[model samples]
Structures are given as structure tokens and as C-alpha cells.
Target: MPRERVIFLVDVQSFFASIEKTADRSLQHKPIVVAGDPERRSGVILAACPLAKQWGIETAEALWEAQQKCPGVTVVKPHMQKYIEISVQLTAIMESFSDLVEPYSIDEQFIDLTPTLHLFGGSPYQAARLLQHKIQQEIGVYARIGIGPNKVLAKMACDNFAKKNKEGIAHISYDTLPATLWPLPVRSLFGVGSRMSRHLERMGIRTIGQLAQTPVERLRKKWGINGERLWLTANGIDESPVSPRSHDEQKAIGHHMTLPRDYETLEQIKVILLELSEEVGRRARRKGYVGDTVSVGVRGARFDLPTGFHRQTKLTEKTNDGLDVFKAAFDLFCTHWDGEPIRSAGVALSGLEPDHCRQLSLFNFETTLKKERLSKAVDHIKNKYGAAAILRAASLTAAGQARDRAQKIGGHYK
Candidate 1:
């Protein structure tokens, strides 16, 4: 008989908030929230502890609203470096259980234990309980694990059932699909978002059981290939491999910043664009790649009527130099900008190629050489001294947040 494929999806509950509680024992059994910036009461909540959930506190809502929900709730800021270190440790632990481990996010991971169960007491459920216990003992946080025959089922079980149970573990298989999975609302399915659920409801499919029974032809006629994928998923069918290397391949390197204050002027916006471009260039060079396309994204400052702009430009000569990327991104921004007050902006470099190989352009030969040399010097200084060692003249202006960002990991405080 073929080996049964057993996948485990594990999630760290209220990750940032839980980390805060772990860091300080006083926060235990209290309603706590993680906010981007407490002073900005309008800032979005990143995470809310289980106690906070009782008052209907939610992530991505304004902190002020969360305060309204629970007047006594405590708000904490994120510590990205600590979270990242813990995530590294968690990944190491998961790899001990199975070599086929993939980190879906900092707080979520998937591990396939089908072929490796014999190494760990010959039971996947036993392994999950052991793993969850280990995380609690080592990291001082709660973790829930869901076991299933595939990634989708594992994730669904983790989110829908395991997360709510006291034991923090749940299992689902082809055998229990009807009893455990089908009765849930169709929106509870992994691929079905709110908008998709509304559309499915229009077609008289309110539950996963209904969706599974609906004709594949009917769904495909409405949604094309996506409908086929959903039909398979609703029926507990997924054939995708649990490949570990899938996340390592890079399609783009980008950096974005949420400005402390709205950037209303051209000079202010231009400075941030240059800073983001430099960061993107440094990362691409570190990865030993050059890119031919540069893209820019701008989010408007209007809170109620939120809108953003995105545009990209292709370069004749591929380069990873910071100045080169800034020039391209700046041009795109100037061309496509609606001149609206901006709340956030980002720069991305894509269509990557190995930095070691390059084709020269006849039109701008000496200019490109100078830019490459200058960018190399900047990267060298920053890497040796610190990211703050080298900053453009524009960054010295009042609009600059470069100095603040240098001390952060992923734009959150260290």
C-alpha cells in the first residue's frame, strides 16, 4: 500500500502579542494588542491576544476602535528582530520533524511527516502534540497544529478547528470530509474569500457540501480555471507537492515605507523614492543579481477614500546600482503621479539577471560605469560602518525617515 500523505500546518497564535506576553509575565491573562505606532491612535492593529478577542478586538482595525471595544486593553509595539529570531528557531524545530518543511509566513509553517513518522515514535498526531508542547516550553507561546492529507486541508483544520480547541490540535482526512469539512460555510474554504463567497451564494452554493455537489461544468463556465481549482478544493482534493525550495526563488526585491506623516510636496516624496530605490538596489546586489524593470507604488493620504497608484518602466540596460534604480523609478513616479498627498510609497526591481553578466549599451556607456562604481562604494561603506554611514543629500532634508528605518527590520522597530 502507498504511504498516506500526512501534512501538518502549525500557527503561532497572536504572534506579536503572544511574544510580548512571553517577554513580560505581567501581560498574562490580559487583553493586549500590537499596534504599529501607539501615538498614531488611527494606526492599524497588527495582532490581538486571545483575551482581547473577547471584546471583538480585531487585527487591521484602528487602535482607537480597539480601545473603544475594550477600554482597558493594553497596546504594544512590534519587535521585528525578536520575532524573526524566534521564527528561525521555530523553523529549525520543524525541520527536525521533517526535512520537507516550508515556512508560509513568520507565524505559520507547513511540515510533511508522512515519510518521516517512523523517526519520531511512528505517529503524526503524537508528533504534533510533542511539537506543540515543545513550542510552548521553549518559546513561551501557544501553537496549534492541524494534520491532514494535504496542505489545504491542514491549513483549513488549523484555522477553523484547531485554533479554537483547548488541546490546540485537530485532524482531518478523506474519510472525515463529509462530517468535518462539508457542513461549514463555503466561505470557510481556503480559496473562498468574502467576494468569492458572495458570488458562490448567488449561484445557490452556501456550504462546502453544496459547492462540492455543484457541477464542475457550471462553475468552470462562470469562473474558468479558478472554478475548477475551487471545485477540487471543496471536495478535499489537492495534488500539489510540498516542495521546500519553492519559496527560495526570487521574482523581485522591493522596499516600502509607511510615512510617519503624509508627504504632500514633490521634494518630500522624491526623497522617500530615492531612499526606497537605494534599499532595493542594495538587496539585489547582495543577492548577486541585476534587474531590467523598476516599479513604483504610491498610496494616497485620503483615509476614507483610499487609493493608490502603481507603474513600471523597462530599462534598456539592466542594472542593480542604487542611482540607476532611483532614476528609473523617479521617472515612472513623475510620469504617472496624480499629485495626490501620499501616505506610503515603494520601489521594486524585477526581471532579474545575474549581476556577473551584463551587456553594455552604446548610448550610455560611461554614465552607467560611473553609476555602478558609485553604488558599489556606497554599499561598501554602508555594510562596513552601518546603513546610516551613507545617505543621499536628499535624506538630510526634513522629509527623510532613512535614519529611523536603518535601525529597523522590515520597517518595524528592532
Candidate 2:
């Protein structure tokens, strides 16, 4: 018979805020939050420390709202690069404990400790405590640990039990699921969001225990495979492995940005579109992939009324060139744009394949070759010097966002 698997999901507490506090000792005891600048249309709370949480400051709330909630709260701008570096260090720490380590997100990771638990006194709780201590000593961050036989249970144990507990560690098993997890509301389950929870409640499945008891056939009929998956999750069954390469496969590559203010003219909106397309193309080239499908998405400034469209077009040839991507995206925007003031725009590429060779056009063979060579040279220069080392003349115009975007990671200042 095979032995049970031991998986742990570790989450850093107030990740961004914690890092800021660790860097500056003076802010250790004060209520602090990491937020984006208000003038940039990114004035949202990204992370809040425990002290800040006491005043009901929550992530995703506007920075102004958080200040109103806690008048003395200290707001800090996010440093995405620093946070990413610390995440890499945390990954290295986990790799020392187990060979199977998977980063679930910037602040959460899963490590399979089944084989290495014996080295840590054969106690999952004690092993968690030691791991927590090591992270606290080396990185100065508190990590909550959830131990279970599968990833779902581990995640639940961490989010629902461990995070609320004083010891910062919790465990769940098949035998204890009835008492530990079933009493919780169905919405509290891992994948059950507000809509799913409402649906489950309407079906008289208000608690995790009720959802678990519902017949699989009924759920399968309602949501197809997703419903069955949710039922399995409620029953504490997950077979997905903690693979490190889970994020390597790419179905699509896209970049989206929220503008600082409304862009009313076609010329201004097209500039942002070209910049996004260029970014998407650059990423595809870096990954050595060529895509034949281009998509454009636009959202209007007015939230009260519906005014946006997402459209895609297929090209005759696959390419990783920024100019080619921009041309395709520009065509899509011209066709679908409704002349409304756009507040956000995005570009994406799909239908991808390896860029091992290019299909040379019969009429434009020389031109294609020259463009490819030029792109290669530009990529080389940008890589060696910096992304801003070379730029299109349009990028320097008032309508362009490349210069400002270059200083940020994921729409936040780095």
C-alpha cells in the first residue's frame, strides 16, 4: 500500500507591508500599508500589516478609504522588484527543506515534505514551527503553514485555520475534515467565490458539509466538470502535483494598463495600443514563440454604462515582431472602437508555436530579412543596456506611456 502524501502551503503574512517593516525598524510597531500612488489611477491598497488591519484597512480598497479608516496609517509605495527578490530568497529556503517546492504566488508556496519529515522529528507541527523560525530568523517574515494530504486541504488549513491561530500552523486530514472544515460556510471553500456561494446557498448547500453531502451527479449536471471538481474539493480530494514547472506553459501572452486619465482621441488611444502590442511582442520574442492571433481590449471611462469591447483577429503568418503585432492590433482597434473615452487598453497574442524559423514572403523577402535583423539588434541592445535604451519616436510624445510604464512592474512602481 502507498503511504499518504504530505503537502504544506506556506503563506507570508502581510507580505509587502512585512518586507517594508523588516527593512525599517522604526515602522515595526506602527500601522502601515503598501499602496499605489493616487494620481496614477492606481491608488489601491496592495497589502496591509496586522496593525493596519486592526483599523479595518483591507487590500484592494482605495488608498483614500484606508486613510479615512485609520487617520494615522503610514502608506508606503510598493517596491515590486524588491518583493520579487525576497520571494526568490524564500523559494531557496523552501528548496533546502524539500525537493518538491512550487510557488503558488508571490507570497504563497507549496512544498511536499513527505520524504523529509523524518529528518525534522517525524512531526508535521514541529517541522512547520522550525521552518517558520528559520524564515523569521533569516528573512524576518512570519509564514503561516498548512499541512495536509493534498494541496486543497493544505491551502484551506493555512487560510482558514493557521492564519487565525496563534501558533501560525495548522493541519487537516480526512479523519478530521468533519470537525475542522465542514462547519465553515460554503463560500469559505477554496474555489467558491461570491457567485458560486450564492448558487450553492440557493440549492440549500450553505455549509461545506452540505456541499460535500450533495450528490456528485447533481453538481456535475449544473456546472459540468467544474461542479464535480468543487464537490471533490469539499471532500478533500485533489490529485494535482506540486510541480515547479506548472507556470511554464503559456496559453497566451498579454499586457494591460489603466491610463492615468481618459483618452478621448483615436491618435492617443492608438499610441497606448501600440505600446501594449510592442510589450506583448517583446515578451513573445524573449520566450521564442510566434503567434498568429492578435487581440485588443478597451474599457471606457464611464463605469455606470457599458462601453468596451474585446476583439481578436488572425494573421496570415506567425510573428514575434513588435511592428507586426502593433499593425494587427491597430486594425482591430480601428474596427471595434466606439469613439468613447477609453480609460484602459490591453493587447494579447495567442495561437502560439515555437519560433524556430520564419516564413519568408515571396515578394518582400529582403524586407523581411532586414526587419528580422533589426529586431534582433534592438532586442540585444535593450537587453544589454536597458529597456529604455531604445524607443520609437512615438514613445516620446505626450500620448505615449512607455517611459512611465518602463519604471513599473505589473502597473505598480518598482
- What RMSD, rounded to one decimal, does every model reach? 3.2, 2.8
Error of 2 at 64 (Å): 2.7
Q: Per-residue CA lDDT of candidate 2, range 206-243, in tens?
A: 99999999999999999999999999999999989988
TM-scores of the candidates are 0.87, 0.89
Global fold similarity of model 2 (TM-score)? 0.89
lDDT of each: 0.89, 0.92
Clashing pairs in 1: none
Judging by lDDT against the true structure, name the best candidate. 2
User: Residue 341, candidate 1: how far off, in angstroms?
Assistant: 6.1
- For model 1, what is the error of residue 244's alpha carbon versus the real structure, in angstroms, after optimal superposition? 2.1
Question: Which runs of model 2 end up more than 4 angstroms from their true locations?
Answer: 115-122, 194-206, 221-224, 264-266, 301-306, 338-341, 356-373
